[model samples]
Target: MVSINDNFHCNGAYVAGDRTIKCWRYPRSHGSETFVQGVQNSCNPVFMAVAERLGADRFYDYMVKFGFTEKTGVDLNGEAVGIIHKKENIGPVELATMSFGQSFQITPLQLLRAASAVVNGGYLITPHFAVKTVDENGNTAKVFEYEKGEQVISEETSAIMRDILESVVSEGTGNKTYIPGYKIGGKTATSEKLPRRSGKYIASFMSFAPADEPQVMCLVLIDEPKGVYYGGTVAGPVMKELLSNILPYMGIERDAEGTEEIFTLMPDVNGMNLKDAEKILKQNGLDVQIRGQGETVYGQFPPADEKINAGTKAIIYIK
Candidate 1:
């Protein structure tokens, strides 16, 4: 892993189309970022450098170690085993591309199984559709047996990875999927389909919540989405919605308080004192920003009763 972050000039060493291979740091123009930031931002070049160092042999070994080379051995029948490239076909370029999760193909089920091991302390788990079996008379018959597979990654490595993944949600590309009260750690992937499939895209986000104590893992994938097919934009919203509903139903207590409410309507702050307006906005989970220097509020952008999502900023003008 990168111990530090700095500028990395690709210089067309690994070119795709007309542009040099590099990470696109969105919203910001240009600067250096930390290693954790790279993971949070889903920086490709940062991972590509690591892949180049690992080379084909070690990289392939890690893939096998993650159970990517074989079936997940789930209880469901007809489970699809993902495909990995042959050893001979894994060149430097292929390895670099695969490092950021491209080129090779894997099923959502396979990914979930591997990801579970990564967060569950390195033990490859068999996903089951049924927890317990029922008899014809609605009596309990048998509970599903679970086998703890060998550790694919070390405990220390898993902990580090969990921390890094958590940053992805809290500080990185997956920030859009973050829920206020939950500690979510995840990665977003935007995979391009082959030309044979008419160059479509699959936007995906995979996450586990309460990083220190993971209760559940979820994956959301949108195939061939129209307009803005980014994992953080499309699939991230879906995962956020699912987690928002399911986490509470599971009776998992939130890590933070006062996060259960959803703010859809912007409250009227006009004609009220600045302090009172700010207080009301805070109560509704909106951040207050003031324009002009007066104490009494004059106007507010988004106005009154406008539809807005939670976590949106409210700008109030005071006279």
Candidate 2:
């Protein structure tokens, strides 16, 4: 989250129409990251450190204010309140994962519910895909009767938070989600749920921007991306592609003037070495990771073929 906010700090929310309805419960903190830094980096450790201060009960209170415990009651059936165990019972690992958006399972609606509060004017909103529903032999009514959730955080907090979110897309974990000149903010997350042998991963990216007011927000989830599965790798790129096309279609103007500079990127070096090819890649704005303490480069992802913005995750099969 720190990573994302840093990039977005350059652009905040854009205002839109009033919430479907108003009245509400809604919903961060200290560190080297500063508010925007923590958000831009999506620093789970930082967010967890803050959540610890907020404590389990306070965190749960924020959850409640966001309406996580209640059913959203959208027009369609099948909706579930996400699971949140007793704060006292929640352990460090569990809390850490939740802080970074893992461990707990939430229906898409539940996820959006929390996100609504984060970017939707400091108020949680019940979402609906349909514009309106026709009444029984009469007029059409708005599909969602927006009941304001709660004001969990201060407006000042919300404003800074929006700026922080923008940093995510601008220069953080969510850089892949940037759309030329538009301001974007949100998070990208990856989960390790299966055995290592299975070699599968879940990558997800979520964003809301034009921070003055958000006209569009989206989340992309890939269950088991076969190649380069981190959210920053698989999901972030996909979100960027979609946003680049959709933002304009939605008539959302770019905050900055258009750009023509195209970046010529270098290769990925995830499981590479401090020496050899890994060093070469780093010279071009790329980064590296090794499996063992061993210094030799091994296999790598993005496999020296795909064209992408530099710094895309490329895990190596280290020696």
**Candidate 1: lDDT of 47?**
76
TM-score of 2: 0.64
User: Could you give the C-alpha RMSD of every candidate to the true structure, in order shown?
Assistant: 8.9, 16.5
Model 1, span 1-319: residue lDDT tens: 3454444433223453344554544433224456676677677777777777678898998888888888888777787778899988887777877888988988888898889889888988877778788999999999977778889888877888899899889888898888876788899988888863476899999999778778899999999989897898889889989988888898976653423344468999889999999999988878778999989999997889886656688999988
The candidate that wins on TM-score is 1
lDDT to native, each model: 0.79, 0.64
Q: lDDT score, residue 244, model 1?
A: 84
How many angstroms is residue 245 displaced in model 1 relative to the true structure, after the best TM-score fit?
A: 0.7
CA lDDT for candidate 1? 0.79
The per-residue C-alpha lDDT of model 2 at residue 33 equals 49
